[model samples]
Target: MRKLANRPGGPKGAAIIRRGWGKVLGGLTLSPLMAVLLTPPAAAQSADISQKVKAECAACHTETGNSIALPFPKLAGLAPDYLAKQLRDFVSGARKNEIMFPIASQLSRADITALADYFSRQKRTPAMVTKPQLLAAGEIVFHQGNKENGVPACAGCHTRNGAGAPRFPMLAAQNPDYVVQQLQNFRSGARTNDFGKLMRTTVSRLTDDEIQAVAQYIASVPPPAGR
Candidate 1:
């Protein structure tokens, strides 16, 4: 009788068969374990950042960064870079806010980054629209500048939906009163931190009516779905 070890498919074939079985067993045993070890749930990831926002920023900005107060700007969905820069400005006295100056002064660069990351991820609540009539004019100003007044379209930098770029800020769903105040500040030179005097030059040409129209339009922007 022929010996099994001396068969045409010899030790090499037997070894390959064993290796295949080992791989199958290893995959079945290790996959679930690896997933549990490597992948944390989303809630777990956000919990620490959520706690920090609650402790330091909830009083004025609210836990979600959607404050209803007129004086405080809604931080939800703001550009992270813009938020970080503003915080740094507060720390350096470039932006004067008695409330923010003290709070921001205490934060380290890492803390600022954490806060910016947290707030930028939050969903913004749309501010209620009070002036429906002005939406047309506001839309015009936002999408197309008045050539005669030398005013550039607000959407040129902020995007058509008001989702702003890295340095610019998201104006959608912002409080109208807050928007007006910032624009006025730009016009009056009270807020000089704007890069290249861009805001000042743009706001200077806007009439009071135009400002109001734009603010109302921005405030009326609907919140993103499922947010």
Candidate 2:
């Protein structure tokens, strides 16, 4: 056999090693650049969704879904699944709202999903509290139910801070008027979309004053961080 170390620092061996290292280094240098080039930006992906929200939803909910108006509920920080379900309910006549029904009817399922995702990620602004007394009264109801009236603690389902679960909605910082209206709706059978009539049952025994107090309390509470 030929002496292995004798020719041009073993030309074929050195050349092969150099080529292999060059390929490895090239790949390492280019990998991140290639990823950046190939991947679409997050903002770019949501651009169309943002436009759609601006055109259709911003009029009432605002661009960030943090509407301050009593007539419109804030959509920010709500669970995406809940938002999507509400949109679908409006479309299907399960939730009756003349304004929302028409708008929701125009949207495709994909549009609803996109809107839900967009709004759910937005930060929620705190709702202004105008009634400290009502808020105090509501806080009691929220944290501890009226056992005499057979009412369960709102926090039991909505969490102590009102962060809410996947199915239950976040009630903290919700518009007081909107919350009251929903409770009335649930009590009167005007809105029946709640799973297993939970809202209806919960609100059934609550007096008008209790409802108002709870709504005021919910409106006054601050949302969880990033919610």
Candidate 3:
């Protein structure tokens, strides 16, 4: 047997190798093999929802609810309750969005719930802060509001790290431009979804510069680890 093994070129050598491989392969079960083939890659697992639903959302928010589009807000990592509320508002015309109103109006309550849950579980990519020069001014605005202008500190509602509370949004890693746009909308009364105009009143006293600075600062705040 030793001599036969040593002589690898022997006629039996080929059969021996095939037999060994067969024995090893025999140990693998069909379920495990199917799972290996069927499972999506780790990074892509976020799109576990139906392809139709994912495609619909992907057009604007992307499958993971993280989009680089400056106009769209990051939906990933936000509380499911908040997302669900926003969707319902859009559907009911409580939140006036020219683009989203039609699409959201068509969705059922279950669809809204599923999308909210799906996006909430997705990990959000970090936002890139433009105009780093404004960071200091932005930080001041975020942490300590301008008393002279009657602007309240953002940290009081958004938390020190901007992680936000139940109704408050998770502002960390949000696009600065989008943040600025929303503030402007609030101040201008173009967007009035905030309960009792809380955002409208809060931003009413903020100057254009202050709004920009605060947005820039918010972009600098990192999202929670692994989220």
Pairs of colliding residues, candidate 3:
none
Least well predicted 10-residue stretch by lDDT in candidate 1: 1-10
Candidate 3 achieves a global lDDT of: 0.83
lDDT of the candidates, in the order given:
0.85, 0.89, 0.83
Give the per-residue lDDT digits (tens) of candidate 3, residues 130-207: 899999999998999999988889998889988888898889888888899999989998888896778898899999
Weakest ten-residue segment in model 3 by summed lDDT:
43-52
Model 2 — TM-score against the truth? 0.80
Candidate with the greatest lDDT versus the true structure? 2
The CA-based lDDT of model 2 is what? 0.89
Q: Point out where model 1 deviates above 4 Å.
A: 1-49, 224-227
Prediction-by-prediction clash tally? 0, 0, 0
> Model 3 off-target regions past 4 Å?
1-48
Candidate 1: residue pairs that collide: none
Error of 2 at 114 (Å): 0.9
What's model 2's lDDT at 206? 96
Candidate 1 per-residue lDDT over residues 79-148, each given as its tens digit: 7889999999999989888888988998889779978988888899878777889999998998997889
